[model samples]
Target: MHLSIGEAPNGAEGGATTATRPRDAQGTNEPAEPGSPSQTIVTFADFGLDPSILKAVAELGYREPTPIQAQAIPVVMAGKDVMGAAQTGTGKTAGFALPIIHKLLPLASTSTSPARHPVRALIIAPTRELADQIHENVKAYSRHTPLRSAVVFGGVDMKPQTAALRGGVEILTATPGRLLDHVEQKSTNLSQVQILVLDEADRMLDMGFLPDIQRIINLLAAQRQSLMFSATFSPEIRKLARSFLKEPQLIEVARRNALADNVEQTVYRVDGDEAKRAAVASLIRDRALEQVIVFSNTKIGAGRLARQLQKEGLKAEAIHGDKSQQERLQTLEAFKQGEIKVLVATDVAARGLDIVELPAVINYDLPHSPEDYVHRIGRTGRAGASGMALSLMVDKDQRALADIEKLTQRKLTVEALAVTLPGRRGDSREFSADAYRGSGREKRGREGTAARRDSSPDRDRSPPARRSGSSPNRSPAKTDPFFSRPYEPAEDAGVEAAAEPAARNGLRRPARKVAALLGGKP
Candidate 1:
């Protein structure tokens, strides 16, 4: 479900309505508010929005307000507290930002005094990317107004953030940690804040930022209008909402935890760990996947596979926590600009990184949690565009796959792949699985060439022949003698532990993949 706030049409009294607007195929309103339960709506001018803000919205190519926008805009225009619930990828950022900008425009115009430089509106996000995203949206919505805005997050340096604050911004979008740091340094103030928005409230709770959030909330004035927006409203979110919002208006576009109907999802049942990578690569080549995002369980796996793809002459790059903010930003920019082709990323780099039209998102490794699976796939299929999500499953990943299917309440189409990506350390000759499973005579006919080797001519080669009396104590490593190395379980350890080398290399390493799910061919 998606939620938003906006103004009622001109001369229409301010009041809240729970009715929904009828949304079209693009999740847009047909001359009505998109995703709205009803066709009824209003214009920005009708809501008494500032000329500057209205002009900015129009310039952004937004014709009519979305459902959330149509319903919520009026209440917000009347200065009421709002609680919005919508799926991710909806225009929630502008839902609150537009009205807030309108309300603050007059205040900003008359209050040029240095004493009033303290922030008047605060937007808190769970991730740096989200914070940056909201900041960008605020800038666009408020472009025609004189309001100044800035973004602050933990991964980057503090000096510049401090400087930005000192320059006087009316609206501040930030991640909690850095925001607290600023408060501790006394470099910024929020005492006079009239509006506060907590975007992605569910994510903040999941991040264990409840304490920090509470602290920030306590510092704000009690008389302020509070708006909390999230993809889902859990019990915890409801409790927290009570403390911050006074008689808040609730808006939900979809039922909780539902995915968009537009996405086409599938799974591949790979038999062995060695085959997974090859299968993904084969899929990429066969499907001619372009601008695709391959998600891995660990940072190392993502990096190693990205580098291997590059070595194979495919453009690839990996992004994770280890990369410096500047490098991550640069790599993301390069990917966006089409300088690279395939992008391998961990879940941390996944959410809130919006690409205009991502086409495919591959689950190189399944997500740890079902909710995360939703978030990962959500990166694609945005804004009514069609998208595809493919999950590569080895034997052990069954449980994770099951959880995802159960949570989504849908069956995923599973198929076998012809090949997979090579393992991280070295490339292996592609082997065919079909030969061994064929009819007996056909298998025997191809055995000599496919098997290629035997323990002298006297040794039997059939499956039954090997099972009859073969020694069990022999090391499994001897089968591939040329580059034999004892198998270490740690090589495929947990996601964070595996990405150490990639973290060390950061963005300096050449050959990274740059794929987004919905854009262009891939």
Candidate 2:
């Protein structure tokens, strides 16, 4: 059955329903549809959007409704739980935002202090940038309406967000962590939240925000209208949806967890870790990479790689959670304007970064989870334009690369970089300076899936396991569980996709450098 909104069980007295906004001087739902669709397709007019909101949509150049918006708006306008899975960049925000705005605009009529009224709608984003983007869109859409919106995220001082909260907002957009901080400090109240939206729920799940999300949910009234949007339907996210959504509508615009067809993915297998960097550099230098974002495993790695390339006279910069907010913004702006050739970053830069014409994304280090790999490559090939995503892999990263291949359900062409083996090469110096001092491996801890066991006969022929110092049950080296195992890259059924090098306007594109951080010659 197609994913559609379902009716609530009887005796559900506290649920929210889609209510029309208060009438204007003319008393109409046409907020401002100057050239709006004449009720032929599902337009803001058909969905009962406020005149102010319709005017905002017209001004924003959104003349048509996407498939998701067409299907979702009507159900959401009826005040039912909605679960939508449309592809990225598909204007999914308005599918729910416009309806929510219409339903809440009526509440403003009864408010004694319109300026200080508590927020009626809450939108949870996975990152500050996304939160800001959604707020911008919401503000633009509700410009003519009486709705006031505020965005809150970490990395900035809470004083400003706190002041905004005190000033009272009609719609609140925030990341989970900062939202919880506000709740803890009693700076914001969600007990009156009429509609709750979890945008990019998949990214939130990938970032391990489930607990924080559940905590936020506990503070809200269970009678509120809930909407969830995710790029993929993993088992965990599905479970979360089941617990929260009461017979919710399920909307999937395309296949689940698959990369866009416009994206060209490739994997380059090198002999050693050193070769990985060389391959990346060769691609930039030889291929003439004009604009690129390289994904590294750690903040230190990202910085070091950027600096290393920069010292080699390639323009590059590193950005992560450690960087000051201003620095991060500056780096992002520079990249967007083509001032830098490469922007090296961790997963913080992975999700929700929308660069219209970004040509390439290099996975300097593959992510362990399949979900992360999808997000990392998702930065490019946006807006239905063709783009390239190249991943560098060595012996150690085989498992991670394999996981990525499985997740995408596609096989990446393994291109080997031509390495000139030198006779009697000097012992490789450790690059673990201050700039390189951090573990690239994410700590799975005891929460992740159990470890895999080594069943090879060579293990039985080798030395016995050593006893642990702390307890008799523990081994000196962590033992793989008998059943649960580390990801096996060899056994994966790789996906099928084209890996040809791309050219724009008959130009052989090469990777460009953005910044340097290793404090050494590139």
Candidate 3:
């Protein structure tokens, strides 16, 4: 049985709405805090979007604008650049996409000619998954319109992407790297682009895409509408905005690194790295968590955690950068379809993944960046749905927890977790540092060495002990008698033997030659 160290509050129900207020210097409006009732009610119909676009919105069952969407849509539709900061899973795509589609509808072409498309709108995302997600949303939003949309990113064959680009698309979603690849190949032109969006702009900077971003900017038309959206606006992001965006309105629905109120945060204090795996297994097993996404700090750690969970009789799989595009997509699909119980992933899946009604998320390792903590848990508790965020924290995690608290502007509840893993013998206190590292062969080698004898100088210089395959005493193999006999010399006068050979050959020898050659007195 598993017991929660800290009893978390079941977050209050009821949705919050955003309304327009006086703009500040950055063109930002403060919405009411979560759970604080607002007198004004806002809806998508108020945005004056085309009837066809409204049809798609109605079909998708979206009623009102999220806080970010409410603040961003009006400013974007007014033909002004915007810099927005909102937590992940906050309908950030719809905030920008709806307006972009609305603005581009007038230019939408019924003709199938390539010149009519001219790449009118471009949305650049940091990861392939995010790009695909944005493309899907844009496609859904613009279904009734004559606008054509497509996505391109690295991984898989570029031939298909090239063909799509050459054919023409009005709305394009692409990653920085692959977009630059298309630029180099001259497969797509960005000159006629009227609107540009940098989704997850901070993540792009973190991934060192500044140079690629600059190159793409150079290719775009000078006069264009641009929007930048991310969870946090770092100094670099601000600098990027200053360089490109002109009099851009700022839209921040939440504070920097602010977590969703709907996710009940809890941390399980594990004894050490060895206990972390057991703790995760115990929590999932005890809670009977049928679906959960466990976050790992590294790709290797994600793979190892997935394996450990599977060994404990859980259906789990890992998705990370090391995986192929198809592999990650398939794994995500399996997890989404309820075929897999657990999905262990790295920060790659932290942003732009829209998993509807995700019940919970577990942190197998605390993130290095405080900002990442927000995105990691943002996968759940989306759209006012209650969810759980559990993290396994060892002694070293205190500093990270502090960073998270400082960024989120709140303290997190951490409680001790006593884990009892099945199919393993002995106390967890006995796990040596090497026991949890690398392959099993290395640990077994150390155990074998300790089993032989205690450390001593004699052991250092002695020959290696025989392995289990060797026998201490055994009969030697038989040998031939003739080969074993001792050497015997024939007693022929050395000079006479040499003289007989020379005489038989009818050859004359120098007087002292034979003696000198034989090492005799000359």
Name the candidate that leads on lDDT: 3
Name model 2 segments beyond 4 Å from true: 1-46, 109-116, 419-522
TM of each candidate vs. truth: 0.74, 0.69, 0.76
Compose the digit string of candidate 2's lDDT tens values, residues 312-420: 6889999887888778878877877889898888886645666666788898888767777776676666556678888877667778877776866788777655632
**Candidate 3: stretches off by over 4 Å:** 1-19, 22-41, 422-522
What are the per-residue Cα lDDT tens digits for candidate 1 across 1-522? 111122111111122334334344454444434433334454556556787887887877677665567666766766778888754555667778888888887667535554656699999998776788789888888887778899999988899999889878899999999999999998889898899999888888987999999999999999999999887678999999998899887765555446666778888765454466666677777778778888987978888788767877788898887888787778777777777778889876755666656778899888888877877777667666788888887657889988988988877877655663343236444444443344645644454343333213444333344565779665665442323555566756644454555578784357576667657543
TM match of model 3 to true structure: 0.76
* Span of 10 residues, lowest total lDDT, candidate 3: 1-10
Residue-wise lDDT of candidate 3 within 249-359, one digit each (tens)? 777666455566878899887545446787788889888788898999999989888888888899999999989999988887787788989999888764576677778
| Model 3 clash number | 0
Clashes of 2: 30
Error of 2 at 415 (Å): 1.4
**Residue pairs in clash, model 3:** none
Query: What's the CA error at residue 186 for candidate 2, in Å?
Result: 2.6
lDDT value for candidate 2? 0.69
